[model samples]
Target: MTLTDRLVRWRYRLVPDHVLGELLSKRWMDNAIPLIILVAVAAVFGSLIPGFYGPQSLSDLARQWGEFALIVLALTIVMAAGGIDLSVGSTFALGNIVALALIGVAGLPVWAVVVLTMACGAAVGLVNGLLVGYLRLRAFLTTLVTLIIVRAVVDMLLLRYAVAIAASFPDSDLWFWFGDGFVAGIPVSVVVAVAVALILHLVLSRTRPGWQVLAVGGSRRSAHNVGIPVRRVICMTYVVSGTLAAGAGVLFASRLGAAGSDIGLGLEIAALTAAVLGGNSLGGGRSSAAKAVIGSLIVMILVNGLVRLGVTSGANSLLLGLVLLIAVAIDVRWLKNRNKVLAKVYVSPTYADLPPAPGTDDGSPYALNDRLRPVEAIGLGEIDGPEDVILDEDDNIYVGNRTGDIVRFLAPDYSRHEVFAHVGGRPLGMALARDGALLVCIGGMGLYRIGQDRTVERLTDETNRSLFSIIDDSRLRLADDLDIAPDGRVFFSEATVRYEMHEWPVDCLESRGNGRIICYDPNSRTTRTVLRNLVFPNGICMTHDGQSFLFAETWACRVSRYWFDGPRKGQVEPIIPDLPGYPDNINRASDGTYWLALVGMRTPAFDLALRMPGFRRRMARRVAPDEWMFPNINTGCVLRFDETGRVIETFWDRKGDNHPMITSMREHKGHLYIGGISNNRIGRLKLEGADPGWTGWQSYWGRA
Candidate 1:
């Protein structure tokens, strides 16, 4: 390789361009924009306003911010349920007046006043809920009416009890503490607000009720069709919103001990501004407590900074209106185009200069031939994608299809077939365990097993995670192939940690090290990574020595050996560094050899594109996925190689009939069975000079 080529390869390898795509794919990325805005606003204010970050100023601001955040949280809940509560401001005023009247006029206990105040707010919310949720009224008009009615009631109550509340002096320690006390150098209101935020966050993210609320918000018709009580969930969201707003009012009243007509006027507009700015979706079903908090901080900081800068309240309101308009525009545009932007950046390509392809002309063992043409098709058009074929002790043929079923063809004739077991998530490579259970590597799921009782159980779906990796690689993404070791540990290959089974071709385009080999110990019930950073690790086969195994890196077009129990444990050595096609499943042959299936052949055009990562990146960006250049997987062949990596022979269907794209093959009882992920039948070829009685089950368990 030239110096320039080596530098380009190293640049792609070290920079980790894929991390940007991975981060963008995450759910938390939605908060990124708001979080950055919050920081920037705080920085600008801190720099401009003297003593803005001082302890005294911050303490005062924290108390006010906490109270405002409570109102925003209330709006967040109602909005998340696909409704809006414009009456929250009036509800806040009502709660404040009630709490004061109970304490001073009625001489009630502080706790009773708190409860009664919240109950009053809940009563108003119940009316709105009944009108909007049950009566199916328009949420916007319903809440707007509630706002006027609740404000009118608050005004009448204030006229009746305003003087008495102002005159009476309550000798309550709890009331005073609620107003002025501090806990751990933080205001009491801020502490309570933080606790409430935590509880609401958990409820929205971790509880069934929270899911129901989101479901109803996303689509009421779909939620009802799925048996969710959509109306009840919506009603409950309004009730929760009212209760939270009242709770915040109690804090405000305790701190200031004042209530008037202007106390909560236009509060809803400010709270709405915070909610949308914090990244909460106005349409619902896409909000979190973190977003409400971020929005609260931005609005409060902006408002307070402007106030300190001698900006008029009228100007402040105008600026807030402008901010809300801008926030709404950004929220709508970002939500609509987020996935489109991610699609453009997510398929990161990397440079891979593979060695020269070996010649497949006549005289070469890798030469094209019609050896597979005479093979007999067992099921023909009756079956679906049987990616891998295996056999049991009784000679019954077992193959996994795309419909998530392990089908069994009865022995002798191979004519009658039945659904052996239904293991979901597209079963890929399968193996016969020594204990007679059928172990399978389901593509999107983890390792699974179908026992003699026909019950399917999951083995392991996760492993130890990489410490510094940006993507969460703990969960198995594509468990492609597996093999059993002598000590009962199962070693499996995960094709790619970055993509799912349907996106396997994208992995080929990138040609990066996103695959790994994992070992699951049955005794300890633990799974760990045995090998890492392989390019599309596909097939795994334990060697005869019982201490080592050979694995095929499909996109790299090579086979390598790894020792797990010998003196060379944890060492990886290349066996076949070059191959003519993308190798797949490796199985033991009856003649002391191994059979490997090349799932697809490499083309000169594609090989040249691999060397030009920039060109591939542009193609992925400019073209649709179906139109992009993909590996030619429609044609492949099965080949036999000895222990020394020497190709003994190959089998191909030159006419492209019977078995054209072979993914796996197994030698059982003098017959070679061929399976392809894209074919509708299983192929059988009679071996003339082989062990007729050697069954894979017997080889592993010794004639149980």
Candidate 2:
């Protein structure tokens, strides 16, 4: 390749083709947000202060952050491993005492004392590791217990040696060098902090052990099943944790010129807050130590600068409290919180109605009808994330609940009735397989084919086996819906793994559309991507023509058609754009037509908000669940069209009587069966004399 070509390739490669866009659009990167904030702060201060640009203040600032930075680095690893260590402060004090005891009491050499202190730290970490890793103890509770015990032990040891250290006289220069020495204009402490960070980054990004640690943190069960030796990695994190805390202790002593009983007090929260603020997950396995270090530095700078600005100690405490709140807000629980962030902001609400199938639409070219209505209130009794729905040959209804399970209703009457499958993890879409079996696209768990006997079997789980062994999360995210070809080739969507179904808002807020259309061949028993790098591929529908299919790209609010055979083989083209609502499921109309369900209506506000990634992410991460600030597809509705890309008729569920968030509605046996991922009842209504042909086909071929 030429230089220019290579450069172009490199740029494209780094550009998160699909997932990266989703991540970037949502401001999902740990560094993305913090980096911006840091730059803004630095710019403001550097411009505001007369001597702010001077090297002296910068150097002092760098040096001043060593303690917190190192501590944060340790906490970053802990959080990344999916846990916390509230006992770090006690461990820090323990390290100082051990170093002092080794040098002054044991008369050990300087280098030996350093090694011994680190070993002592490892031993302390071992205890914590054993408790947390082997015993499977809650990290918070174990660390809390360890903190108290370790502090008590340190206090007792200090009282025993207080007089001896004082009388022994001049003490050791070794402790001072390890703590407060300078090397090439940078303090040894700062150098150590940087080195630790570099080492951590390498472990996290390049090493197998680091990968295991992350896997363990993110999902411990997943790491164990994948043969990652999770316990060993978890225990070792504590070892590293203790070592860093001890090292920080040495730095503390050198900085302070002496060790005391109250050494390294109350620093755990600072480290955790730093790690979280730096963009690491408290939910484990998603962390960056480097980001944590920078976060630590930011915290230190804020604290020091605030103090310098004559801020009261009380105000400083409040600032710390606020920083902690922000850090906590970055959690997965916070991210998945649907009630807080309105739908349209996190997940795009605007989806254009696909061109009507041949003869049913408004007789116009493909586009949303100008008559689209916006509603101020929906009368549907509490509905949640409606992913997809299914209907039986009898026209009985079934809705897949994103947060819960399936719901079914009686035919034509819309009387709520049953739940055929209670399988958990966001259930997206469902369809009746040819064999009289109900198949569901269970998000996180895989594509489940449930038999009439209610026997749930996972027919397709590994999507190309890309991360089979490294499946940190066992749930299947085979998104919104699926369509089976006549030959039983199941085409499904694998949406962004970066965000879970409930947490899909994060993906939207981050805008990293790492999505793909996967084809699962039943005969070959293989799942492969038909198209990769899509913006958040949602629903799938196969045409009775057997030549092409349609699917939704939710975040982009577009519906597209993909040709499976003939002249345009493997080609994809946009069928509709600028949808009025977030499109969910697409089903064939019984009367040689097609139906597209509108889950929510999109607004103009969302399009402009996409440009402001930071604001979007903040809204997702920090806003109230039901706050009107977030945009949502205004109301639930469905659209019908003939096969030739024409506008048919639009059927709306303005009262949510048919179901709010109309994820699915399949025409079967002269009745329209409506299902939703989060609807309380599947709805059924007759289309009067409509028959998609198969009247006697099911009985003739035995449920064909």
Candidate 3:
């Protein structure tokens, strides 16, 4: 192992997983760390230098920082929107020159000069915007060219009228006061810069346009696909940059009382440096205007402290460049490996090791024998990954496929299959409502209803998220299975909040309590959490007595019953615990028993990994996804349990030739329909001596 790897491993071993996980999971930590570093640097400097924090020194720092602060703000806007404005330095100088020319050459009023100068700045921005946005020119190259052209133009203008403008505008008192005047003990420029920062911060964070800018910056192609007017948003950012740059220029002229050619010579680099230091990414789509101000403060402090410490200007430049390089390197690395890093620190809950499974021929109730008689392969190659199978009143079979479609086979022969509805998500457990609408629990989405006409409507996608989540948790992440109660209330199990539906194995690895059971009431049109902090709650089944429902926590290898009626109402109790496999879907059978589909038989290696949380966390990080040791989903069996949770029967495909990884099974009309998440075909088995006329719909609605 590399030295760095060994050190990181050692550090992790020494620290508790929860402490590291919580600290690393916080979103604000990235921004807060830089601010903290800045404070620490300031403390070191303050202790070394006298009067560093005094009012006079502070006032001087604020006064000098105002114009540069405005320039930094401009850079931040353009950078956040995935573009850069290298012409800002030239634009600032041009604005001041325009103001000076309007006042001195045309003899215009101060207000007219200010208005014309700003217009000139906007005109420059318009050119840049058109070139970069409409003409599809590269931002960096186009702005670089504009920077040179504007600077040359400003230089020529200054050369010709240098003597005349300065001589004519000698006694411009209002202009001088605008740059240097104080309002309530603060410089006017400082006040203006601060006000602009606050306003822009609000706009960027709280407004749609600001979000559009970020969206475009994150990915221009994605923004275009989503119809976000990518070009317009990009163009607007340049215009704002130009406008702010002009304001900074006016302040620059006022503060210095001269429109010097070198006034904005290195302002662009300074602004870019400050923005980068403040946590703005060069690649775009991430920034905070408030953090830009903090970055600017850091830059100013660094420069001022170097000067006070008798450091040369050359050394100061070198130090700033070095800091920028280091910060960018760290930021890029963090961005690339954030997920891996998080996985390493994730604190998974410890689980007890499962016992060895009984032999297939042992004759135990949970034994894996050849009880599942495969009769036919329905939709063999046409449908893929039919995780759940169901039946309607006519014995028309329905199965939700992986391609976000609910496929239905006609009754009698079950030969003709067609798409019943396109739910646009991975549909799992489904139930029929009293009004004939098909209620489905869509993975990654929420509960949805398919009308008799096959029109899909979203029922509910949100519940009270845990307050401890780092990201917004209102939206459902993995709504896995659902079952409807007698009173028309729909209960669903959200598999895991930490991982998406496809990343179910990650939940198994984490073994954390990130799952919950939620209920949606049709009359109230609302969804609320009924149980919280479960470990991969997968399948759900309502009881025949209509008093309680059973839910399977896959990672925990247990089934829990939540009673809402009778003496046990408002209580939750474990009905089935410590199973030999990870259960997927549970459904009511025709013979007053529940059929549980064991998705995967647990192995000793995986169970041992579950008990060792530290090993799982490290494995999640160090191992590639394909190489990760997931639950043994390649082989599975079906188990029948009574109301008291006693194992009554077992069914297995020992060789997995016809059906494997059985996730769900439904019993109807003397036939047992079975489906798997990884299998290409649905299996049918003849149930000998079973009720030939019994249907799943009649079992629920009683021949309605």
Candidate 4:
């Protein structure tokens, strides 16, 4: 390793928390150049100057600059987004003064003071947000003017009225703990500063708002294109920063027991220095709250150390100014400003390098799985609620089209097609008999059997007795999927016992979870519920042993397995939680494997579903009868799993971008016959390396 890299390595192993360990590295450049340089200067100064780096000296240094570092963190956020908040120093001073006045003069409780101080801070921040976001002004100049006005107001408050009241009320116990208090071990100021850093860091890195902040900073135009709320996010940043600043002010007054003119003195310079030193440039992207704190620590440590070393305060200021100037100049050393701005605008979210969210059967990892080869689209128009695919003895693909058509697509090349059955009223789930006759879940028309002569025969239209809650208007018009047991009995799921297909999300939001997994006995001509209150149960697949079946409860984003024959008979357990997408239909493949069709992805919309349950039920009751409420049907995908529920490979279609919606897929012989609930043409993806080991009847008949 290079000399500088070795230093960074050693520092990271030792004093890593101080500078985030970049000071010891050689390759350290870009945004963090200022911080690295400051650390190097600290090292050089401490080594050359006597008494520097001593424990007591460093502690004092850190304590004095604590407020400055806090201001820097607040300022860094504003500047990083190509905006400025010069009112920060004034706000800082006002916060400290207001907090002291509340506790000492107002004769109120400590909690009340904290709340009022925070509200005051938020009001200041909101004004800033309102001015720049709504009024539209140059951030630097706008904040500069605000700084003057706010400072004048602070001067009037202290020299005005609140200060006199506080001085006269020194005997009051209101300022007892707040003016000088400690809970467990640490100082309250230190705790507040650290808390602010930790929370904002998480909000920016892990939550949706953080993404929006970066997007707005990166490029307002680009942010809008990707659906980031450019104005609201930007405005919210001001609020967060302002609120945090207010909190810090409360701590300052509590610790000091006094508010003075010097409360926010020179805080802007130090905060700006810490931010630039720690990284995050005005180029509008790339800032970390953690690094900003580290930068703040470095400054605090240096000043305290110098003072403990018996260096004069004047000498320390001179040294810090020289070092910070050199540190900031390095930010401009690499690129002209314009290129830097453009780079931030074009970059995607930072964590794009991480793996996709769990259960994302997007086929990205299985792109080399041969079956996922990019091919021409034979053009499938919008198909409807297709729940299953069955290949008859003729090798012809039969798909249960939700629009009441048993659609057929030819083999080898998907060049020919015909209606194999037209059993109206939303034909959804489908199953092929041993003799190749099709059993279908004709929504609202009961399950139907498709005869060889292309005629539809009604099976059981309704259950023997509907549950009291599911009478007449049970909304079984949205039956989802089915699987046949070894005894020829079919088990199916009615996706909702209340709302129709369009309101599935509404059902989840309502937490009714009223769906049921029902059994259809062909001999008795009866349908009965085996499991009820299943929470939007959608997909069903019988196990190889016929003891139980696995079903997908879509709204819960989980898979459920019910084993009826084993020692664990009649019990349900989670097979998997948080499937990458919303599960729709599942069928057993020939090789003891299972294939699942994802109707749509579980995205941000689903998150909103959990919080707005009442809104969902109301919407469910109002939406039109035929409106399909899912996402991006233009693209759909499928997942494969072993008997143990381990994911094997993924097959996906990118819609017009690649192919089209493939809601249901099946492996027949060596080919994957694809069908969509709404696609006009059936997809035929040749499994180039696959063996013809999974034909439905052959496996069931022991003829494979």
Candidate 5:
């Protein structure tokens, strides 16, 4: 190999380009930009302004930020429920005046006054909710009208009670402490804000009401069709928003000990700015309390810094407006293009150097022929993508359909097929247990079994997780095939950990070792990884000795043996290093041999592309998925090999008529039954001079 080629291969392997894709796939990545801005803003202000990070400065900032966070969180909730509340600023002023009037003028207890203040806010919100939700008015216009009405009420109330609230002071220590007191060196208002944020976070993320609110926001018609009580959820969101706004106003009243016209003027703009800047989607359906808190900090720091720098009020407003516009633009554009970005970066291709494929020319041992063309097709056009075929003791043919069903065709006639079991996942490899249960490896689900009475049960869906691995490999992604050992242990192949069953083509593009062999032991009710880092490990078959098993790595185009019980336990030895096509499933033959299915044939051009990882990477990025060159899977053949991996014979469907993509085959009662994942039928070929009474069930577990 050239030095340049070697360096390129090493660079792709060692640098872990796939890590960036994995990180981007995470949901938390949406918060990345806002976090960066917060850090940058804090650093800049800290460096430019004197005593910006000092304890006294922070303490005062905390008091203001905490109160503002509550208001922002209130706005976030309303926005998440697919509604907007323009009345929040007026609601805050009304709450502040009510709290002061109830405490100082009415001589009410501090606790009662707090509750009354929140009630006043709830009353205002109820008016907005009734108009926007039940009356089916536009949220934007309805809330705007409510804003004017609430502002007028607050002005009149202030005019009447402003003098009394300023003259008479409340003697309650708790009321004063609510504003100035500290808990463990943290301001009380800050502590309350944090507590409320946690509760709101849980409510939105973990509770059913929160899910309904988000659902309503995402699409009201869809949410209503799903019976989510859309209008009620929208109504509740406004109520919660008003309550939270009023709660923030209580803190404002306690701290300042006064009520005025400018108490909450233009507060709604600041709250909205923080909500969108912190990564909450303004178009609704996506938001969180933590985002509200982060946004609140950014706006509070910026405005406070500008104010201390002696910036004019008009300039401060203008700057905030610009920031809001930028934030909204980012939110809208990011939401629109996030999935497209993820699709481009998530499929990272890696360098793969496959061995030279063996020749399939005429007269060669792997010669192509039309032998499978003459085979009899069973359940033609009725069965759908039967990936594997098996037979019971009575010659009853069983096949897995793509629609998550195991179909059983009766013996002798093979005319009528019945749904033997509905396992609800795409069943791939199946085996008959000693007690008449059929064990199956479902594609997305893990191991499962169907009893004789047709009751389905899940065996294991997870295995021991790999420590220090970025991806969670414990959960089964694609349990492709399986074979049972003598000791009740079922060994299976998970095709790829990074992709699902539908994304198998994409996994082939990566050509990385993302597959693993897992063993599920019924005795311990435990599943564990026996071997890992194989390239698309597709099929598994236990050897006759019960000490080791053979498995096929499809993308690697090789068969390997691994010891599980003997002295060489956990040791791996390659059996077949090179093949002309991609291998799918390995099954035992009746004549002390094994049958291997090559699901697709290899092409010279594709083989060359595999060695050039950069070329494949460009292809994936520069073209549509359907336009990408994939492995030639539409035409393949089946072959038989001995224990030493010597090719005894081969069968081909060169005309592509009967069974083209042969994924699996089984020897039963003198016939080789073939199945393909892309074919609509199962093919049965009569074998010459083969054992007429051999069955896979009998070979594994002795005949009853």
Candidate 6:
């Protein structure tokens, strides 16, 4: 390989994947980058320009910052709610004109004038809201039209009465103080702007209205389905936008002692630029008001510095336009390739090469066999990716589907099926509680309970996060498979904390210890980590004697035993090592043994890739997701193991015609029901010698 390849390989060996993944996945990283840029810009200008950091320049900046900053805050709220108000500049100018007219000609009190001016602005906002929210008009187009109409009306009013208003109100100390007064060295307008920004920040981050706004922005259909008043939320955002813009206008007019037609010109572009620079998404949902303020400060500083340098207004506009374009391009590209970028930065673990697989000869345990009888396909096209299968006391088969549903197949012929529960997340492993309640591990959501009445309740979704972790580790990301202990404790395995459920292949490539085994006590309603730092822990099963449990670590291709009562209690020991294929779920066999399902067999190419950590990391970043080397899950086998962990017998669909990628198998009433992660329907095999009445429930809980 080239020198660059060699250097990357050496670097990969020096760092761990989990550590790198944790650093890249931090939430603060988004805001931190822009904050750093702001600081750098400020420092460069402060050192290069004379009087840039002086008190006089700072005070003037504070006073001027309020006008545009308020407008920026207005745009931020609307943007967060998945809408934009292009009419803000026009509303600001109109507010100025109305304030002048009411005070100069109408001879109204300052307080009454302020209220009337604000009311007019609110009226314009109400119209915009009605069009966008209730009338279903496009926000951008509707607001653009409003901008034209409001500007036109403001121009007409100015043409008719501007000279009279200007002559009537030549001096008003009270009004000027609203813009020029200072408290604790901060201008009154600056204080108002800061307070408003703070309040908006709190509302968006902590209040119900803010959540409703974000929810609507995130997905309007979803918000409506969840019973949120989508229209009302959208309407309220525009109202806030117009009111804030109007307040900015009053401040601007007061500071200048005149209401000019061009006073609010180009203010919209500045506000939008500031919001975008602060990391506010144009597509909406994920933004903060605090970011807008910081963005506004950056814009103000840049403009002030440019003016000090005697840059032409045209050049200033060009520079601002370039900044906006570059910032947006960077933000969009980073968001699109965030996962790939993260993969490039991290070092995945490398594994020892896989040994040669045993031939499928007559003497081999995995020899070609047709002992697994084919059954009619049930829910053939209806179910998707039944990763794990279970049965209720009445022999009703329950399968977890890829579309976040738990489907139940009726007994006898297993023809009739219906959706049992909609978990809203990919459901993986499932178990039957002693009380007949169903416990399910929803991939991204966490552990949940489904009662017979069809009520779904979340059991637990958090564990004690590692103190050293920068990201919040409390939330489970990929809860894979679960099994219950006799003493009312529920045990489950989180496949990979570093990646989500859909990114299982990426986790395999990483081959790092990002998985953990957790136990939840129903009596105490507590969940705690029992074992940690496992490599893609997949399936879990409690031992028959209630003394230990078997957990399959997929990437490691090994099964481990954790004892609860024996001398090895609190310690883990390998039960089976160096498996030919990656194991998935473990189920109790009827004859006092266990059945282990191998999801995929390791291939030579994947084995070599595992040994080269740097190669895998590069592949993850450069290769398309579908083209990435994944575990060979197209062919698998189920092996029966004795209590001593010795292989008893193996059953395989050698050609993978009837069933492939067998992830889980459970014996009930002499029929072995098999499930696969990518199969449309489950497979059933008849075991002639096995007890026809034996069930997995009896194997665990015994006959009542």
Report the number of the highest-TM-score candidate. 1
Measured by TM-score, how close is model 2 to the native structure?
0.50
lDDT of 4 by residue, 1-704 (tens): 45754553354345313122222221233434455656776887788777665665544444455556667778767765657677787888888888777777776777788889888888888888888876777777777787788788888887865555457444544455543444474444555567777876887688877767776777878888998767776676677667767777876776666766666766666666667667666666667676678678667666655765789967976877885786567556543553544323211111001112373434443332224445444436535545567776667767766566777877645467777767767777777776566878765666677777777787665664454442343335667677778788888888765556655544544444467887878888777777876767877887788788899887566777997567988899877665666676777665678888766655665444343433443444455424524333455667778766677877765434444556567777776766666666556666656667557666655562
Lowest summed-lDDT stretch of 10 residues in model 4? 346-355
Q: Write the per-residue lDDT of candidate 1 for residues 455-517, one digit (tens) a residue.
A: 999999999999997788999999999999998999999999999999999999999999999
- Per-candidate TM vs. native? 0.97, 0.50, 0.83, 0.48, 0.93, 0.77
Please give the ranking of all candidate structures by lDDT, highest first, separated by commas. Answer: 1, 5, 6, 3, 2, 4
Clashes of each: 0, 55, 0, 18, 0, 0
Better of 4 and 6 by TM-score: 6
* Cα misplacement distance, residue 256 of candidate 5 (Å): 3.2
Candidate 2 achieves a global lDDT of 0.68
Candidate 3 backbone collisions, by pair: none
How would you encode candidate 2's per-residue C-alpha lDDT over 1-704 as one tens digit per residue?
Answer: 45754564355446433343334334335477777766776676667666764777866677657867877888778878888889888988887777666666777777887788878778888999999988999889999999999999899988987666555433666566655567887888889888888998899989988898889987888888878888888899988998888888767655564557757676786677777777788888777766887688667767777766789978877788788897687655555753344343434322112221222244433333322223222214433554555566665556655555665655655534566667776677776677767777777677777788877777877665445322222234646578777777888877765566566655555444467787778788776767766777878888766788888887666788999877989888777755656777787776666788776766657655654444554564466645524447446677886655564678664555335556666666765656555564445566656865443124212444
Candidates in order have lDDT scores of: 0.90, 0.68, 0.83, 0.65, 0.90, 0.84
Any idea what lDDT model 6 has?
0.84
lDDT of 3: 0.83
True-structure Cα RMSD, model 3: 5.3
lDDT string for model 3 (369-424, tens) is 66664557887898898988988887788889899999998988877999999988
